[model samples]
Target: MDEMAHKYAHILVAVDGSDGAEVALNKAIESVKHSQGATLDILRVLDLNSLEYGGAGIALDGERIYKIEQANEDYMLKLKERLLKDNEIEHDALRVHLRFGNPKIVILDFQKEYQNDLIIVGSTGKNFIERLVVGSVASYIIRNANCDVLMARTAVNKSK
Candidate 1:
């Protein structure tokens, strides 16, 4: 057990089903494993802005929304299983949460509620043009989060 890992009693990780996120998740699991009694919170925020709009500028229909929500839930479940299988951490030490809204906002709110000592998030490595149009959630979190932020840089981003 390293001293750095023991510094955080509560760790919050934001996962968006991306490879970078998987890296961050793995780091969070390792930190929790090394830190006795530390808990890990896995948060998946469904970015409403990514959803398709209807003819009148309204959001997708209820049925479509329901299906998307169900799919996201299933993905989270599978993610949890993978985390457990890949690591030796106890199931009770991990907590999973799903929310519908802007990811940056939801993550900030969760951090406030949980009072996490550390926040682990994956860098998406979006190009300048894409970031200008869509905005970068990781950038926003790094600037706004109250706790320590760990940006996991994926191998793909390292080559660039």
Candidate 2:
């Protein structure tokens, strides 16, 4: 690899269990494979704001929150297991983080705290109006993150 080519030493990939996120995770794995001594962090943020609005004005009770958290944990664990089985990377080289807060803020904060060299995120392929209403975490990270951001597009989208 050319010295001029950017080599990420610490990669942070945000995953939400979406197809796009799966693509981003694969991309991160590949990047880490090429970069010596690189570590990969997979993060899943349970957006509190989304949950609040998701209930249509009803606040989530404690039991509901616990259930959601548990489900998120299970999902992350499954993802980790799949990655380990399918990739050559060691178990210790990969870390999974499940956090609560706004997705954008949590991701940016994590990158800053870890001083990650690169951030990988998946594009939801939301239309203009939907993006305007729900907000695009990838777009926000690209505009604000201090490190390099990779917005992994779905394979279907790439053909277009």
**Residue 53 of model 2, lDDT score:** 38
Deviation from truth (RMSD, Å), model 2: 2.7
State the displacement of the C-alpha of residue 39, model 2, in Å, after optimal TM-score superposition.
Answer: 0.5
Residue lDDT tens for model 1, 19-97: 8788888788889999989999999999776766665467787898888889988988887888888888889888888
With a 3 Å backbone cut-off (N, CA, C), the pairs that clash in candidate 1 are: none
Q: Quote the lDDT for 51 in model 1.
A: 69
- TM of each candidate vs. truth: 0.88, 0.88
lDDT of 2 at 48: 63
How high is the lDDT of residue 43 in model 1? 96
What tens digits encode model 2's per-residue C-alpha lDDT throughout 93-149?
888999999988999999999889899999875789989997888999999999999
In candidate 1, position 60 carries an lDDT of 82
* Candidate 2 regions with alpha-carbon error over 4 angstroms: 1-6, 52-55, 157-160
Error of 1 at 4 (Å): 2.1
